[model samples]
Target: MNLRSLTVLGAALLLAACTTPLQPGEKRYSAAELLALKPADLSWPATSTVGERALREAAVADIRARLVLPAGPEREAALPKLFDLVAQYNAEIAAARPLLLQALPTLGQRDAETQRALLTAAHTLYATDAAPLIWPLLPQLTTSKPFAIAAYTLLQADGAAADRLRVMLPQQFPSWADDARLTALMQRLRPSAAAQPPLAELLAAPLRPGFPVIVSLQRPGRQVMGLALVRDAGGRFVRDGAGQLFTSPQLALARSGLPGTITNGNTPQGLFTVVGAGTATNPNIGPTPYLHSKLPVEATPAEFEHVPAPGAAAWDEALYDSYLPPSWRAWPPIKEALLSGRAGRDELLVHGNTINPAYYAGTTYHPGAPQQGCLVSHEDWDAATGRLVASRQLTLAQTYAGAGARSDLAGYLIVVELPGEGAVTPAEAHALVMAAGR
Candidate 1:
């Protein structure tokens, strides 16, 4: 054979040798195994032109091929690995749904544990994308505990989607009436449903004459970053030359879970008008209270199942009743309901961290670590400047207080969640509120 042909044959042999074969009795790759494979390895032909969605699609196809095993231990083992791959890539549900449907019949015939996993994956995909594709499958899985929990979570957090879900599948709502946990969730959800305005309404709503603050916590790519925009008296969001909101230097100094239904670690989203301000002395964080709201506390369900860990109770308590600056509170009726315990939690605040400033400066402080739910910012001591660098929380409190002094109307705080890939931008937020009024 010619040298050119021999070299091509050698390369093919080398490529085959490098590929890891399935383990003994293993029908598919494990999560670790799949995660270890690079995007290039998963993509067709190792081409750089393959986009992220295409790469994810190829991975889903590969995993789906391994799922052909019969309804038994082998297939059951393969299922989790497939799910792990799907989650890692955040695969487009539209591309992955066909494989999920193909596996359902076999999965249903398997043991209850296997069925639960399948349902959980379906619920996850639905939650991740809010895709309608999973709706048809949800009816069948409503009886599953995992599915019920998932449905309750989504329903509590999203007003528009929850309304639609109720209309589309009325039976699914009542199915969980007997479940104690779901019952509690439903009770808490009622108030949230009443309190949360529709997205369109929220987007279009006019800024109260006083200073207006709009906070958008969006999952752009993977990390969720929050942008705080303040409206001038003219009702335009303060922006710089590039059109980015003129954000406080300390932006998202701490992290929280997505906005909506209050989990201990999650920040709740809604419209709040500042009502009262006070100082509270706490042993952990010291005496530095500014403004406080009942919003976070009232918004939280009395009880919700979260992944259990140490410090969860403390984290929830802090988020529910933490202090804010003097200028922040909800409108009268909402305030009364929250205070009376008829609605949301009390003591929610825009506040600083409990950690020592000396150790925390120039560092991202996650007070509750993996489970902090409050809207918190950090204070840093700038040694060179010989001054304390205030957080966005402080800046916002001061800005609103100033705006309140100039106008009779109270300033409003609107927190909204932006889902599904940069769905909302800071500039868009200003346009939305202004357009809503027009």
Candidate 2:
């Protein structure tokens, strides 16, 4: 099959694995049966429709109860999948705490895959709570990059452990060191509260003119969260009645939870060319149309700037700096997408989530889930009817569409990591956009 067909098939299989439930009146598999089935056959990742919250909650509870099941092969095999469900839904992890604590002692005896999964689970579900447990097991799993990264996530909470992991980062994930941004990211986990330049200052970092742009502003930590502002071809922002720029909450967390320097990690902060827009075949993203964008190196500088091909330019220091203002060009954190694309991270886009928002109801970015290194705007879908209810992504697409008919749905997406701990509020975005305008 061709690449496009393969992509469709893969998305279909993933949607089936992650969301499809047993047909009406079909036999509901018991937890044991669920565990015995293959990856594609396990169907506990249920989606809730407009009014079926209770049904989905009960199903989640059933799966949570299995966390305390007798510790053995079944539990070991199920631990990763269970943790994934928890992360996917941002579900409560109180029950799984005991199970994770129980599994700690036997980690050395488990296979590397299981150990890595356990570490990942602890990182995702327990966070700092699992640090104490994970610290003791790191020596056993430090050789594996995935295991080390997951352990580092929890261990970073403890000062001594954080110091140790900082040293190991360069040694364990050596390739990451090639890009100074990845190394700097490890060192600056909790960014100092420095006064940031006005939004006008950041936007002054010159982008090619005459193309609509979607700028996503994220915190320095590269968390799966941020705010996205849309600009028209003439560099105008949509404003609220009060004349503040309209902003949408966008999630930039990648499913892999790795740094952007690696494949399938956090969304890198940089520019992307919006080459096309359309409905996604992937159920995880649902029916909302997404803007297909390509990063630098993924697209040549000519293509990236929407100009005719100049002689083949290398993705070197000069080319990378051309996209940034001279003042901000030397900063390493902002160079993530350039290095990420050079390192082979591709297929990035601005899209919406189909995963049920109830999964993340209590979280800060409620109704938004992590994507595969894409800028995901909040989108609510009625699972029963398979219909879009509300979508910030749609608004974004329409805004881009209305900007100009010249390229029809093509432009640029510039993602920047701002310096802050909280989500970028609409007020903040408005202030910045207005400041830039003035």
Candidate 3:
């Protein structure tokens, strides 16, 4: 396998192993997965193609070494398109952002298809404006299958749109590296042939070894957590690895660190949820948090600077990860209807920001701290024997007790995901953990 095979999301799959060290190939997401996300914009850390790897290295460097503050529009204009890509990636990954970049070259040519894509994504990105033509512009997506498929994929991930691409990609998603595979999947989008799947096996659940079993998380408010995996004797999960734990001082800090505020080498620990997934920018760091949403889901090196974070002392000041904390949460049990396939050793995290004014202020379950940051694991087992007799696994840990504490040097929460199932619910889960404390 190439470097892409060893990409980050793979490694993240194993970090849920609380007591054990994070396994290799543990990652949050890959470049391909990022592409699939089709955020509002697109960008990278610049390229060898750009030649100038560093901002200063760019032959067309913008700011004079003296300009203390460079937020002026002059700076924006002088910055390389590559930098625009970088800045755009950090702000928001919504379709509008991507269209600004992906459709740029075509827009200059005034391609009708390009215009349609730009407009379609704009509705979601800039919802302020809407009129009679919003409906008509949509039909163009069918004519421009490539743009349509990308849009379809984004919404499907959000569970807000239908998988029209399914009508296009009946075979499989092609390789991101191999140009050939990509072409084949795209070619199938033509209007000539039957674009639907076979019928006989349609309604049936297609003997999926086993379905994704649900698991409710406590602290059921905005900060609710989620995942589905099981454990072994070594205090690790025996089956799937959705909640694999990374046992790094840096990672531990980030997990238990304060949120919104930048802190030490330690990441913050307030209430947070898994929003989406992405590739880790730091190769040294395994399985950074997975960030999602059609909006901003990344961070730049500058973000880790002398900011107020939990592990401020531990903050590297040198590295950053593409991963981000969540904005809202659905909890792990919802994945039962979301994720489908034969789950192997995998850890698919989907979280959101823990503090939501609307949900927390009004909802009954006000999940906070350890409960909000908790990673609920789901296990599919023999209903009777209670033995984890299936493939779907259980998440095996919980949040730290003193997650946000600046004191308690060695303080940490005793972990166990304990995804709620048959007899357990969010309230029940919390009560059990609380009782155990006694």
lDDT at 153, model 2: 61
Q: Where does candidate 1 have its weakest 10-residue lDDT segment?
A: 13-22
lDDT of 3 by residue, 1-438 (tens): 222332233333223222122245644443234333321222222211232133223211221221222444433222223222222122232322433443333333345444443433332233223222232333343333334334332432343333454443333333421332223223323322422221111111111112111122222112333222221212221222463222211012112211111111012121122222433332211122333211011211122221235333331212111111121122222121111111111122322211111212332222221211223222222323322321111112212211112111111111122333322243443343234231
- Winning candidate number (lDDT): 2
Model 3, position 354: C-alpha lDDT score: 16
Clashing pairs in 2: 224-253
Give per-residue lDDT, candidate 3, residue 50. Answer: 31
TM-score for predicted model 2 compared with the true structure: 0.73
Weakest lDDT window of 10 consecutive positions for candidate 3: 336-345
Pick the winner on TM-score between candidates 2 and 3: 2
Model 2 residue 417 CA deviation in Å:
3.5
Candidate 2 per-residue lDDT, tens place, 307-395, comes to 67674476676777776676666566567677777766677767777666655666665556775567788765546654555678777
Per-residue lDDT, model 2, residue 418, is 72
